[model samples]
Target: MERIIGLIDMDCFYAQVEQRDKPELWGKPVIVVQHSRRGVQGGILAVSYEARGFGVKRGMTVAEAKQLCPDLATCLVPIGEYADKADIQKYRNASAEVFDVLNNFDSNIVVEKASVDEAFLDLSIYVDNIIEKFKEGVDLILPEFLPSSHIADGHDKNENDDERISRISTFLESSQNDISLLRLAIAALTIEQIRKQIRDKTQFFCSAGIANNKMMAKLVCARHKPRQQTIVPFKYVREILKTTPIRDVRGFGGKMGQKIQERLNIMTMGEILSIDFNKVVESFPDEHEWLLSVAEGYDSEPVKARSESSSIAVSKNFPGRNAINMVQELRQWLDGLTKELAKRLVTDQLQNKRTAENLVFALATEDGRPQKTLKLVSYHPDILIDMLWKAIKPLNKASDEQTWHPKIYNLYLGATKFVPGIPTANRDITEWLNSKGKKSSDEPLTDEIVFVHEEKKVYCPQPSTSRSDSVIVLDDDDDDEKEVPITEDDEEYIEVDGKRFSKTVFKNLPVMLRKQYEHKIALETARKLKMNAKSSRKRGNSLVAAEQSHMKKHKPLTSFFRKK
Candidate 1:
């Protein structure tokens, strides 16, 4: 079955959310700016269509935008001591509402949120069901059912206008015989319904594109503006590509796209489709299959209904003279960022049922941007700060001498990738436990093992006895147990049999093993006390013997008053 996919792009997402919340702000020029600590002139993150008419664009400073549009209304993203990075949780919440509306469209539909303001939906199941209904006693859907949308025919003039109903009638009449076109028609109809529900429920407008695959769906989505849907029939794919720039395609918007342009000596996607892409793209053999598929107007990649994001990051940019040259300023930013990041991780865990497997901290200077990745077992705020601070110390240090450390202009803290489940009861760990014939910590550990809540790493001093249990399970024979993630906090350590275990990781150990370590520590302390007392007694006897020997020598000097 041909897949019917739709891409939904929210119109001026952050700006739209602001205008929607304040009914008075409608029809006015508005832009959302990230708050700057220096003043009200932060960088613009979103620009409304009204603002764009006045030559305002995103990435311009608030002052610049206001200069362009005298009547512009500006709103700042949430900012505070903790959110020195400018928090966009409000927009994030708004996004959830939008996706919630989209998800409720049909039980068979699959929604893949592509970004904060974009999502790809697999509408094949819904379209197939609608097609089956047409085969039923029900007559074909009426043209009135087809709402306003673009056809994406590569025409200089838009044929889709107020007379969209007429166009829809003609299109439907033509598609009655061709099943492929009929599938697209049904998908368009479904999108129209979804868009109507979204606007009615959320008061937020979005544009959608319907096609046979993800690439076409995304390409056609931008053909129309807010509150509209576009459809690209299978027959029109070639004409659409004829005008589309290869860079405009999703994956080719960056460095890879530049290489393709130089190597293939082509700028347009259609030109490549006409050429022998296989013979020309020999250097990029890895991309051969994808490029060939694109040449044929096909993208077999499925719409991934991913619940957890690959990475969740927050960053703040310090432009121009606001760059941080002092170590203290960088430390402040790092402290704030780590605190904010910890909160984000908690939110992600509750929402996605997953936590980050690694923490990525990045620093951007004019010269270069450096990033550090460390294992993250615990999201404790203190641990995050300490680990990140230690990582940056080797790179930068403020001094009287012109230091090699570049002034930091941007700061970022984010999770690299998420672990599948919450740390409490991870499915992967459970599977591993079962394979080892060991019950989960929640269950008995052969001798009354207990599960503990989130705990910090606890380190014992290097064991004096070779008989102590190692960091792994005390008696487990598996020499190759997978290492669980642990915080890189240097302050916490517990050495058992010369092996190191993080405090947080050790806390997760079976209660039985933890008790053994505690008992051993007490025994070692008592033994140390006994050994010290014995040594002190020996020193006292040696001192008495030395004194008696000195008296026997009889060579002691007398005081000045009683010289002898």
Candidate 2:
């Protein structure tokens, strides 16, 4: 059985919805933004097709967009406004209406919501049925029903046009009595009825494609845009793909298309099909099979029914370097993302059944270099300020050197490893005390110390000057170096006199106490060169001599002493 796939992309979704609700803004080009601030230059969520023609694009700043077209009218995208329950219900109703209309034909129909305004429908069976009906109708309406006829004068017909006139008269008589003509009329009427039903039932204006495979069907759908249908016979599949760019094909985007072009020199789907299977595998080892299948218009991947997700993620790309102001901007984005996720979870009836585990954070430089971090949190909050802070803690510093405050362009946050936290575990005093090892009866250990296995380890070294005073007193007979059994289960805290002390306490303990308690177990480490002027002066003499000898010999250490 042949397959027909229809890719229905809405023409500027957000702008269209806004225009639909507000009749006055019908023909005007609309741009959706986050805010109307100047320096902020909020991201353009969506731009109408009319605005697109005037050089406006999604992600363009409102200020720059206005410069492109001074008359451009813009609207701030209310985050939860479009994704509200009412809006979602409306969208679902619209989708169901379209799906029901498409299901009328005898076909295996698969409808997927690609986005708010876009959906992909697999109508192979429907297309084939339509084609079969058309073929049957054509058979009925052809030569038999409309037999060739000729005009003849009575006297001349008998003499001059005897053979032709007799043949025409016989054919006309047969045409007048032909049952095929009656069947043809019936088929035509039936097609019109089907078309009318589809239009009347579903408000969505759709363009359909009838083809042998999904790829051909998709291509045919684009032949006539806005509201028209096109049918591509099985024979035209190869020719159609031959001229279409590889990027134009569904699922081929960004890096994938570039890789195909560079490795296989395949710019179009036809060229991809021409390559050998082995060569395709060599170029894209992981995705070769899938790529080949799509190239050949053979996709059997089933449409997945929507399910309640454990977590939701939202990510965004900013334009410039992330500064203090950018942090505020990130908070705003997180607020929007978290709000949307919460709304979705609540509406799906899975709110209390799940809990957000950790917030994953990622930052990208202007050139798209990314630095990612994550932090686990126990609570779900509407505003993700605490989560954001936890994620950013490792990257933040009083002095910017510890942080890569480069022109950060991208930020992302996601929750994962959700587990239901119901039926709270009973508190066990004996077990908790044993876990922390009962230090003293009066000083009850806290739960924070009890859960040591799951906590992150902190590393701090004592100052070199302080360690210099502690001299190693070795016994001649003590030849065996006792190895400390540092098991993975050991907590990061230092144990002193059967008491567990936090990392900060251990670092700032009195000098005498540290020497008495930790010096015996301390390992000797190499001294680090100070970046101060005094150290620089002393190192300068040796550096000059080393540089005179050879460039490579001192090249490595030059950057350390050089004035920044």
Candidate 3:
């Protein structure tokens, strides 16, 4: 069976998220930049198409972005508005929401999250079903299904969408025997639906690519982006990869790929086919034998869904001049991180129904090496602060409460050892609120905090002076170099009856959060009324028995004999 893979990449994810939440940002020149106390020196993380139209691109500083587009709307990666602390739980939450929608789209269609803004979906089952329907004369690839799809045939031609879809549908009807093309064409219809549902539910648009395998699907998905789907037929697979650079494929851009290119005298993926296979295998024996398979368009990596992260962490790099040794600064940053962690835990409960059992820390010193530590306490701020502070104190023996030497360059805080902590909608908020005092008193911290410093440390250079003032954030194409999106993970939620909630948006609500407060209130009120009526009847019966007992004790009534 031919595998039909679809990859969804969110366009300008950070900026798009900002636009989705704030209506005024629609159609504006929006840009996401990493903020620093150094002001507009922070680099641009993402650029809206409107801002891009003015020649603004990623890696440019906020100043340069605004210089190009004078009215550019600059949004900061809110690692911390007050301190250089980084916490981007919000982006992670958005990512979970996007993945949730895709995961729930079709049960048989397997979805694998490639990253926060990308997912790989295996549509083999859907394709097979569609093909079966086509054979049984019970199906038709309707024109409306692929309203915004394009074919990746190395063409620069454009046509009316209505004409193109109708034309494609007619071609598909006639080419029923060609299963290869037929499956992909049908897969495009499903891809269109996936895109539509994402937009309808989330208010965030995504671009999709459909191909025979993960590699081709990812490559073609990025072909036509922002809000479109591209289909690269099996016939055109080699044709497209003929001139494609190998660096575009993951894991092939590093030293290994360069060495292969130098030794094998190959640059494009298709060149591997032209070269001698035996010699190529001999040259790079251990590392890149799979290049040949991928070059031949035979990526067999299954699209498997990953379990929720065992750990949720937030880290910030101080980098050179921004490095901190002051005790006060360190405490403040840790406090900020803990607060972010606590908030994110709530989100995790709602999204994944899980929470952490222990707190973990990684403190990177000025030498660019981290001192890893683990603690016994839960995610509570005070316990974490006391425990994490004590854990750090032993390392900084030279310093006191005010300051320390050999300043810290990086800090990471996270929660791990996840246990189920479901945020049920029917959960009693009143009881939970009342448990705050007892919970603190009931829980105990008995385990001695453990610190395990990795004796093996690699020398990492400090962030250059230029990077301090104007750091350019890069694209997330390379997993090894992916920049962590930063902001408060305070869940995208609507408040109802003083409780925060994140839900699937039916309409006006932002995806993962909706406006059903009134509806919820109505149901809760009805439930309460039913319970109260039952209680009232029970109380009335008890009162009658008590009154009768009082009358019997008094013996003042003449007609007291009733029961035999």
Compared to the true structure, candidate 1 yields what TM-score?
Answer: 0.71
- Expressed as tens digits, the lDDT of each residue in 311-332 for candidate 1 is 8777877788888887777778
Q: Lowest-scoring 10 consecutive residues by lDDT in candidate 1?
A: 555-564
Model 3 agreement with the true structure over 1-564: per-residue lDDT tens digits:
779899999988899888876889989999977766555347777899899899999988777777899999977776542235443546765676678679887787888878889888898987686555445443445555567777776552354566556556764674456777777876777777677767765778899988888889888877766687888877777877777788887567788668768988988878888888788778868745687777777788898975377677777778888888787787888877765665455445434546466677887886556555574444344556778887877777453557766688888888778776422222212222233335455474221111111222111111011111111122234212111212224425344544432321112222122222344456467655655665566665554454454335323111211222
Pairs of residues at least 3 apart in sequence or in different chains that clash in candidate 1: 456-503, 456-504, 457-503, 457-504, 458-503, 459-493, 459-494, 460-494
Candidate 2 lDDT over residue span 1-564, tens digit each: 434454554445566556655767767878866642233436787787678789999877788899998988877654332121111333433444444544443334556555545555655444344444544322222222211222121122233335544543443344335433232222222322333444454423444444444555456555544344444433445666677788887667687888899999878887887888799888889998888767666657544322234455555555433332344545565565554443333222222334454566676654444445454432233234465666565554335443344445655666666564311121111233243343655664321211111112211121111111111111234422221224323435565433344444455433433543463233111111222333455665564554344333322211212121
* Models sorted by TM-score, best on top: 1, 3, 2
Tell me the TM-score of each prediction against the true structure: 0.71, 0.49, 0.69
lDDT of each: 0.68, 0.46, 0.63
Task: Output the worst ten-in-a-row residue range by lDDT, candidate 2.
Answer: 463-472
Q: Once superposed on the true structure, which residue ranges of model 1 sit more than 4 Å away at CA?
A: 160-163, 276-279, 282-289, 319-321, 365-369, 397-404, 424-564
Clashing pairs in 3: 88-487, 89-489, 90-489
Cα error, candidate 1, residue 446 (Å): 43
